[model samples]
Target chain A: MVVEVRLFASFREGRFKEKELELPEGSSLGDLLAQLEIAQKDAKITIVNGSAVSAEHKLSDHDVIAIFPPIAGG
Target chain B: MAGYAGTFLRINLSTGQIDKESLDLELAAKFIGGRGLASYFLTQEVDPDVEPLDPANKLIVATGPLTGSRAPTGGRYMVVTKSPLSGTIASSNSGGFWGAELKRAGYDFIIIEGKSDKPCYIHINDDTVEIRDAGKYWGKLVGETTDLLLEDTGDPKARVLTIGPAGEKLSLLAAIMNDKYRAAGRSGVGAVMGSKNLKAIVARGTGKLKPAREDECKSVVKNALKKIRENDVTSKGLPTYGTSVLVNVINESGIYPTNNFQESYFPTADKTSGETLAEKYLVRNVACFACPIACGRYSKVGEVEGEGPEYETIWSYGASCGVDDLEAIIKANNWCNEYGLDTISAGATIACAMELCQKGLVDPDEIDGPALEFGSGEAIVEWTRKMGESEGFGAKLALGSARLAEQYGAPELSMSVKKLELPAYDVRGIQGHGLQSATSNRGGCHVRGYLIAPEIIGLPEKLDPLSLEGKAVWVKIFQDLTAVIDSLGLCLFTSFALGADDYRDMFNAIAGQDLTTESLLQAGDRIWNLERMFNLNAGVGPEQDKLPRRLLAEPISSGPCKGHVHRLPELLPEYYKERGWDEKGLPTEEKLAQLEIA
Candidate 1:
């Protein structure tokens, strides 16, 4: 299976803005975070496709995951 | 008296009479200060039905109790008047050195009544106030006006507040620019100033402000500084990238309005995100007086240097116009600052025009400049200049989106509420924010409540954005609390790290008043109800408390939040109830009595 990952704000430092990575099916969001070397605590806002989800949520083929640090401005 | 300057200035421009009057302490206690107190005076002094640009209209500039104090982000002020755009009570807020200087000048506020016989500007020193001829500075842009005023005053350190050609020509989209780049940037406040034939206000002061309970105030301020330093949003994100950082986060949520809100998602949004801004054109981070967060961005596009292209500005010029050209957006932002136009209204009006042209309502021969088309960087830039200058076809654009769309026979195309253009968020996906926008006292505004903190950023706690459950209650509380923050002369961003209790402590220590959290919020409630009453009396009643038709009827075409329309129908009634208003959205007599406003 393949998943697209999006990073924003400070979370993108020394990392990619967005990219697709090959992963085994049934990988939990936590497992993907670990694979990307991002801490669970640092992923303050996690979105699967377009809905906010928890790290324990499972990922599937072609799922788009977006992770942001604790950030806000308006 | 401890928190405020104890004195205010009443300048009758029509008679050239400058009167120094004592601030009404009892009224300040009830309304807090700045926005709240100013609105109180406006309602009492001016008729609600008066034409907004008539000599009968009053423009009040006021500072909060905390303004120029030791409090964090305390350099704030409010420009309160009836909005020519929304026909609602307008209290546009801004931060910079000008507000703090006004505090030090021993005046809590200034009320400019009647129209001036000729163009003039006010110059204020500690004990000297004069209205001088501004014949040489009449048609200059904001930046040039500020420079010439400072030179004329012969005080290099004095701060200048002025409107540009947009206001001089009475474009409804004009803004009041201060300290070169800062603005009270909504609701056509500048037009009111221009109608008075007022050119600028220059202030230089050396006085100091002292809190009522010096020791307690110091301790509370210390604690607030610590919390602000620890908060990630304040300490890291905003300081690093400014407010533009929200570009990607909001876009990723799929609620970012695109192309006059005909769409909700823009795939190329990253090109205009904060990350791109920092990497491309950032010159430096700027801070207001006594500010620790420093969310202001100073950027340069080639030879031109200016401030901002903030999150809302980026959305208005970039995604809402379907133009992903970041440099073009920056240039347009510069035009707005120079010409004294509200970027959101100017850009959204252009987007509405683009859609009108696309639908054949706007004839090609009618356009005197560049083609009105989405994704045309040239159109966004040139049209903005034209709007500010009120030139040719740009004159139509200066009327703002609601009027422009209505003139073309498609009022539904204007993405506005109560005639004020909506900001960046496509509220269809964010239910609570939608309710807030629909009922905002000054029309489609986000700062009145800022439900985005809890719904999108998960500040205090995250709530499901799409859920309608308990959203009415959330919107009511947020709106009330926000009124308190605005009145106190503090930036709304402080709410991210602080709570009601924190504000209560600060206010008590400064104002020598013991207000419990409940009582403090009641004051906010009082201010909100007063604004509502003014609007109702002005004929903007319950019927105006509605979202645009598209927001209620059309579901987002495609996005992560596709197939969702703002559930305002379910939220409005609940919100009215929570606000202690009757079914028709009028404040109940008993409720007004409880708030001591009756």
Candidate 2:
């Protein structure tokens, strides 16, 4: 299955801001973070299809994912 | 003088008495400086029941130990006064070069008391402090006054803090502007300054700041700067996008307050986002004295050019007003800066009026102005100008949203806390932020306890933004820590890169104290409690610590935050308990005694 993942803030530094990922259908969100070489502790927020979820949650095909480091303004 | 100048400049405008007094070292150690020390003096000197704009009220501008030193983001100062808007303790903070200059002039704080018979300006050149006539500059705009004051003082490098027409008219939302654009912009502090018949303060200094341990301070500053550079949010995102970068991210989160918070999401948000600003009108970036992040934006809109429309201003003039025109938002920002107005209050107030007009509660003809339909950028700009000038429909709008909404028989329509207009974030989605707004010392300000860091952006923690569990615990911590930062005269943005440990090392080196992060935070807790008790004596108690009815009862209608109504009642009790306050939200006698607050 293929999914699109987006990164923001520090996560965008060494890694590409966004990418198309090819993974197994049963892959968990943690599996993708490992592939991106981002430690689970460092990734502050992970949203799948616009809802926050645990990193260990299983992913499905075409599920949009976004990872953001801690960010604040205002 | 190490870290602290330990001098107070007291001026009584009415009696024309000026005195330089010693700053008690014990008091300095207890209260620190900037907001902490200023709040201490305010509670001590100003009578609690005194009218906010009365001559009996005092206005204090203070700098902290880190100010003018090698500390990064040190060009900071704070204005503390009784707010004419909320009738509570007001502490408005700003960043630029003026506070640092004042410190170099050898004073930790300036306490202005009484009112002058005529318009005047305070001129300080090192040791020489004079109250000079300001007839020529009284009515001028902030930019004009700054330029004129520099020429008048014959020191082109002199920095000025001045009020514009809004302040002169005693507008409740008026702001005091410095460095041409930076402002002590919240809680009607400028109105108090205006009430004193004071127009400007010009500062020019030639001196130095001596840290207690110079070598240790230098090394700490270098390490701090390196850490700041290493932080992605501080070094890269902020410098590149400014605060306006939050638009897309916040809008995507479905918590961006739009059109007087009638909606939580706007399809046109991208039109006024940071990404668009950077790609379009951004000219360059600017920084405060000794600042490493340089999050300040320098931009232009057609012929008009100036400093900001940071995220708050963008949300104020753009989403809050139902106008997504970035150019218009920029222009309104320029107008607010030059006119000496608080853009958040002005735009949000006008938005309330716009909503009234939409509901047929206020006829457009009654406003004595054009149609106030949503998305009318022209109306937003024109109404803002009118509010500053105190003309036409702007006259009623100048009273701020709470009063205007009440006059229209719909007080609940105003989105505010303690009569102060809510800023950019619609608290409906961000649970912790909403609670913080309600309990904030100076009404509806976001910076008082910026839970947005954890609530929405997930800074340092990824709590469920919708959860209510353990929020009170974290909010108390954030509030206490923020009080320490504000008192230290360091920009709060540094929290993104540095934590309590970094602050403790720098503070200990400069202030000659062996402080752990725990003790530093205790001072912050003391400061917060002092301000709270001050407000209680001023008649703002737990009742005032509440969100507008619209937020508490009316839930968001669409987007990710849909059907979310603010649930402050469920959290306020816990919050008070966490702060060691009683059920009434007043600090218990034991807590006050424990903190050793007199």
Candidate 3:
């Protein structure tokens, strides 16, 4: 299965605004993170469409994933 | 005194008498510091029935223990006074080096009472305090006054808070500008300063604020800074774009309040977004006294290079007024900062006038021949200067939105609560935000509650923004947590990444007292109730805790949430119940007892 990922702000600076990645039928969030070419390991991730899921939770096809960096402004 | 200066300076401007009082440990333990301490002093000293602009009214400047320390974002202070705008208790917080400097000057707070016979500035050099004549700086802009004070004091690092011509003219929406751009900018605190004939306050302190247990506190501070640097939002998004980054994100979510809440989104939002500002105007990044994030941006709007407007300023001046010209918005921001005015209130007031003009309720002659049309960048800049200087149309605008609408025989059209104008967020689309705004102690304000964390940004947790269900509970929790953070003098922005437990940890480390999460929240609840009590005693009640008729009756004409109206009536009951208040919005005796306020 393939899923779409969206990144914002500095993450976009790294040309990671959108990505198409292949995954197993039921790959966990941890598995997807391990497979992605994201340079930073401490990046915060948010699933924009799906429920708040942990790294161990499995993902489905067509799930929109949104990732962010730390918050700074008030 | 692990985290205190051990003294409070009291200045009676009328007699030009200054005295120092020792900090009371019992009050410190009960009220904490900053907003909490300021409220305590206001309640204890100032009479509730006195006019906010009268000599009897008092202005309190307070600093928390964590302020001026190595704590991340510790450079914060609050100005508490009887607000001329709302005629109720008002506490306006500011982020700058001034707060930290006060703490370093061997004083936890400074309380000014009795109007001065003439214009003067308070000068405090560690262990020494005097009220000096400020005749030269009487009508100067905020930036100019700050420069003159620093030069006269011969201390480049001297922290200053000064009012501009707006305050000198006693404009109802005047504010005190500190550290150049950071402001205690709500509810006419600057007017109170003006009433006291205070033009500025300059302080220079060489004393260090060392913690009792330096090693432990240093470790805690280091870890917190490291955590902030690692946080994705603080490390990259905020530092890179500042708060203007929210423009695109909010606009994308279809909750950007445009054209005086007539619409939920702005079409030209991208033109005024952080990305656009970074590409065009951004010159450098600035930070408050000890802030490590450096989220403050200094930008060049045309030839002027200074502190740029933040997210709220952009929305209030740009999108809210239907103008998308970033440079014009920047210019308006500069005018407000220089003139010592609250940008949120000033912009909102102008937006209200523009809406009146669109409805044919206000004549062009009333606005000095300008059409006062939405999206007119030139008009915004022009009227803003007029308002700051209290000239012509600006004189009417200086009366604020509520008064302007009332004068036009359309008070309901004013998008304000208790006379104070609303902030950037449109409550029509964000339900919880509406509840918070309506119930704010100082009238329509976002800082009092800020339900946007869950409803819009989805920080810590996510919730449906359109839903009214559970909104009452959400608003209560956010309000309590925010009260705790504000009283402790911690930057409320940290709540974006840190939770209640994280705050509790820091509070315990700084005060050298063990504080459980429950106790901390209770402290916040106590502070909230105390503020409410002050307001209620000052004559604001259930009638004041309501949104304008337009928000409750009129639906959005277009957008994703088109035809949506605020459910304030339906939510009010639940909100009161959650807050342990009655229908009159008074804290129940039982609730007060639980918080130990009784």
Q: Arrange candidates by TM-score, highest first: which order?
A: 1, 2, 3
Candidate 3 Cα deviation (angstroms), residue B7: 0.4
Model 2 stretches with alpha carbons more than 4 Å out: A1-46, A54-70
Give model 2's TM-score for chain A to 2 decimal places: 0.93
Across B281-363, the per-residue lDDT of candidate 1 in tens digits comes to 99998999999999899999998889998989999999999999999999999999999999989999999999999899988
- Candidate 2 vs candidate 3: the DockQ winner is 2
TM-scores for candidates 1 onward, in order: 0.99, 0.95, 0.92
Model 2 over residues B401-435: C-alpha lDDT tens digits?
Answer: 99999999999889889999999887878789888
Which window of 10 residues has the lowest lDDT sum in candidate 3 chain B?
B246-255
Fnat across every predicted model, in order: 0.80, 0.34, 0.30
* Comparison by lDDT, 1 against 3, better one: 1
- Let me know the TM-score candidate 2 reaches against the reference structure: 0.95
The DockQ of each candidate is 0.86, 0.37, 0.23
Q: Report model 3's TM-score to 2 decimal places.
A: 0.92
Candidate 3 local lDDT, B219-275, one digit each (tens)? 777777777777767677788899887775666555678998888779788788787
Comparing 1 and 3 by DockQ, which wins?
A: 1
Q: Looking at model 1 chain B, which ten-residue stretch has the lowest summed lDDT? A: B146-155
By DockQ, highest first, what's the ranking?
1, 2, 3
